[model samples]
Target: MLTHPSDPRRVLVERSDLDPMALPPDLRRYEIHLRATFDWGRAYLTNPHPDLGRSGSVCPFVSASLKRERFFLAVHPGTPSDPAEAVDTMRFYRDWFLELAPRSQPSAQITTILVLFPDVPQDAVEPLVDDVQAMLKPEYVGQGLMIGEFHNGPPAKSGLWNSDFRPLRSPVPMLVVRHMVPTDYPFLRDDPEQARMYLELFGDQVPAQLRDQVERERAVGAP
Candidate 1:
């Protein structure tokens, strides 16, 4: 987690006092930027090397909005030195999602939920649909949560959670772009295309008054 030495009061995980069940420790609150990127899966933190090891990191967490940048909530079991333990840990994450999603706030729900898993196929997660539903009640605003499988190497369009694998029928747009490999800056950086795409899709969130100013500021790399 990022920390600030100059301002010790600036805490990343402050509301740890909330009911953990409804607000799990893994969930984080962030002010979502119109064109900013969120690292929910902590793909970069888990996979330091883009070439070797298991597929990218599976940040087993969920996000919601309380009117700010973006929030990330997740649990890190301290890297497991044992391979078997790692697998078990991941399996636990898959199972835990069942409990976490439902506990999430019904009103502060996001439009999209993306889950990136290991090499496992959708079939592995298909059986958990019932569990997923139980956790995510009908009131949830998102069309549905997307679950995808990921692996290491160059970026590929195929995975358990790939867009081609399980596409969303509803207008709600949520994607889990897993980095096949890791690097210093693994979280996919926002490019011009991505920026424009976000503005088009989530432009509603951008206040009309600052919309033009925001565009102008970006053009000159301000703020």
Candidate 2:
């Protein structure tokens, strides 16, 4: 169990260190949800599936993240119904994610932070989780990081290879934060500012198919 530097009450556990019995009494209640999240990562994210419509695992980074002990999970202490509060909570984790160990390159690329919300009800998923994601995404992308929303509502963001596959769906509502990689252009291309940010970070490394779009957006300048 690793205690967050800034906030001692907030605890983060690596995938390999996840053990319900080891958690403090106050944190034990989250064990079931945490276990489910761990299982889901192994069974889905790290494995290749016929329905994924691609040759690789659902998330190309998960296997390496798990192996390197860079994948972290934490149950948020508060479940704020208001989008404003939720946005603030997610932003805190965004900054915390940058401060966590393995801040260097290569290893840092695979580091991931998954902040789960077990107390949030199914009805509130959209406003609290999805809307917060939309509100904070530009800031996250501009900083060369990615923030993703997942919930049992089965988020509308579909898989790149399979249109019908809702890859963001998770057993629990959560927000995932990770450093942006060259392969993330697909998610940034739709927003001109985000596209320019992506081009600035990745340069000619942007996929050939999207280079024209990025160049066109760059010509238009920041909007």
lDDT of 2 by residue, 96-198 (tens): 8888733466688888889898998778876788988999999999888899999988889888888988888899999999999888988987887897788
TM-score of each: 0.25, 0.91
Query: Which number leads on lDDT?
Result: 2
Q: Give lDDT tens digits, candidate 1, residues 33-80.
A: 111223322223223333333354323222223123123222222333
Mark the regions of model 2 whose C-alpha exceeds 4 Å error after superposition: 101-103, 208-223
In candidate 1, how many Å is residue 30 off? 17
Candidate 2 accuracy as TM-score: 0.91
Q: Which stretches of candidate 1 lie over 4 Å from their true place?
A: 1-71, 75-83, 103-146, 149-154, 158-223
Candidate 2, residue 60: the lDDT equals: 89
